[model samples]
Target: MTTVQQSFPVPPQVLWNALPAGVTAIGGQGPFYDAQRGYVTCRTGMTFFSWGQVVTAMVSPAAQGSTITVQTALKFGVFDWGEGKRLGTRFATAVAYAAGTAALT
Candidate 1:
């Protein structure tokens, strides 16, 4: 498992709207967004080094704007060899871009 969190200078709704695009950027599908619950999940295809991964993003309100915590877990494996971390970072970065806001310091 791996997790990456990013803060953006935008509302939670703005970040939520970018969840789908973020999933796509990481070669995943179906963001399965739950606005009321403030969470999203995606299913990634199998890769050469991985069986597959389930990527989830949790959105929360922040004082500055919003914070998104992206987590990636393998479908079947004890270790992902950094693949999960990479995917989580990719998803978070894509969401920041799609939200039209840079990451907060």
Candidate 2:
């Protein structure tokens, strides 16, 4: 089990909207926000693993900006752990890209 955490300052809606679209194809989609929880899915590639699940919890907001924290737990069944790590890395890259895109808009 590995835990990855990141925190940055950005407008709430900017981060939220950018995040879902970033994770669209690689087993990530359908990001919904609710009063209690935020729901999203992440899938690892077949090369390394079959599937991956990432459940994110929306955190509190800052005065000037907001923070979105995602905690991902990888479960690789009959798959290479390296693949899972790569997927995680890709996800992070996507998040960073989202942030950058939001800044541009």
Candidate 3:
């Protein structure tokens, strides 16, 4: 299991949208998103033989915009090879870019 947290300068919904899109861009699949709960779950799976991954994200209102907490768990693994950190960075960058674009528009 791994956890990554980031603060975004956009509303929760905006950040939420950015997150799943980034995840999808990098092979994440079957995202179950819940706006009311500000939560999203995506299956970051590789081979069908494996149970895959459960990537859960929590987006909450924050001082400037929103705070996102991402929890990642593989179906079964001894440890992660920094994949969680990579995913976290990817989502954060995407969210920031989206927010900046939205603000400019």
Candidate 4:
């Protein structure tokens, strides 16, 4: 799995609410939020260079704001050739943009 973690100067709920939009911006599908689990999950579409990936964003409260940890893994392979990390970065950027914090990039 490829993981990307980021901290934002916003409430956990704010970041959590932006997860779906972030996923969609990355060309993900079926973004599902599990409030009880404190996470959002989505799947990437298949393309010529990839088989698809499962992306998960877990949000947690912080002292001042919030922190998000995003994990990306290939649906059917042991190696993703850095695609997972790329997708994770894009997801985080989109979430930051949606949350009105474009400085996260």
Candidate 5:
């Protein structure tokens, strides 16, 4: 149930290409892309506990910049805490980096 949200000004395609490879390698699930669906999917996993893990992401383009949001639900053992707890312990480990390949003019 943990959620992490971040927004920065970046060009659309530059952000898009960086997403798949960047997110997955951090211990998430996929570079799930569907042209028709028009989005990319990413997931995260738990170590010893199944329910403690989570997977969530969003991909969209806007006039100013592209937006990507990633979220995961974490369950610690038998305890089901909300997004805050899960995000603090589990989701924090996941790292994503974005760099602009070229300037947009």
Candidate 6:
């Protein structure tokens, strides 16, 4: 599994609102958010991918704003050929774009 974690100044609710659009931008569907757990899950429509390329976005309180992590695993393979990293980058980019942030780390 590969994970992309980023910190932003937006609150969880704001991030939650941006999630669906962001996920859709990356060919993801059925985004589900758990407020209690601060988790958002979805399935990606990535090519060469079976076994449900799941993406999990986690949000937590941060000193400045909030920290969000989007994690994905490439099933049925030991190596993803950087696909996991690409997925993370895509998700982070969407979120950052929605949040109106200058950039993500």
- The number of the candidate with the highest TM-score is 1
Q: Candidate 3, residues 1-105: lDDT per residue as tens digits?
A: 778787766777778777656566547788787888988788776643344667787889888778878787877776667776666666655656766643211
Give the clashing pairs for model 1.
none
lDDT of residue 92 for candidate 1: 88
- Per-residue lDDT for 15-79 in model 1, tens only? 98888878889988765878789998988988987999999999999999999999899999888
Candidate with the larger TM-score of 3 and 5 = 3
Q: TM-score each candidate.
A: 0.94, 0.56, 0.77, 0.90, 0.54, 0.84
lDDT string for model 2 (18-73, tens) is 56644653466455556444434454433325456554535346664665555455
**lDDT against true structure, model 5:** 0.49
Those runs of model 5 whose alpha carbons end farther than 4 Å from true positions after fitting are: 49-52, 62-64, 74-96, 101-105
Which 10 consecutive positions of candidate 3 have the poorest summed lDDT?
96-105
Q: By TM-score, is 2 or 6 better?
A: 6
lDDT (10s digit) by residue, model 4, range 1-105: 999999888998999888877888789888888999899889998866579999999999877688889999888877788888899989988989899985333
The C-alpha stretches of model 3 lying farther than 4 A from their native spots are 47-51, 101-105
Q: Once superposed on the true structure, which residue ranges of model 4 sit more than 4 Å away at CA?
A: 102-105
Clashing pairs for predicted structure model 6, backbone only: none
lDDT of 6 by residue, 1-105 (tens): 899888888776777667775687678878887888978888876476455478888877787678878898865667777777788778877877887774434
RMSD after CA superposition, every candidate: 1.0, 4.7, 4.2, 1.7, 5.7, 2.0
- lDDT-based ranking: 1, 4, 6, 3, 2, 5
- Give the clashing pairs for model 3: none
Worst 10 residues of 6 by lDDT: 44-53
Tell how far residue 65 is off in model 4, in angstroms. 0.8
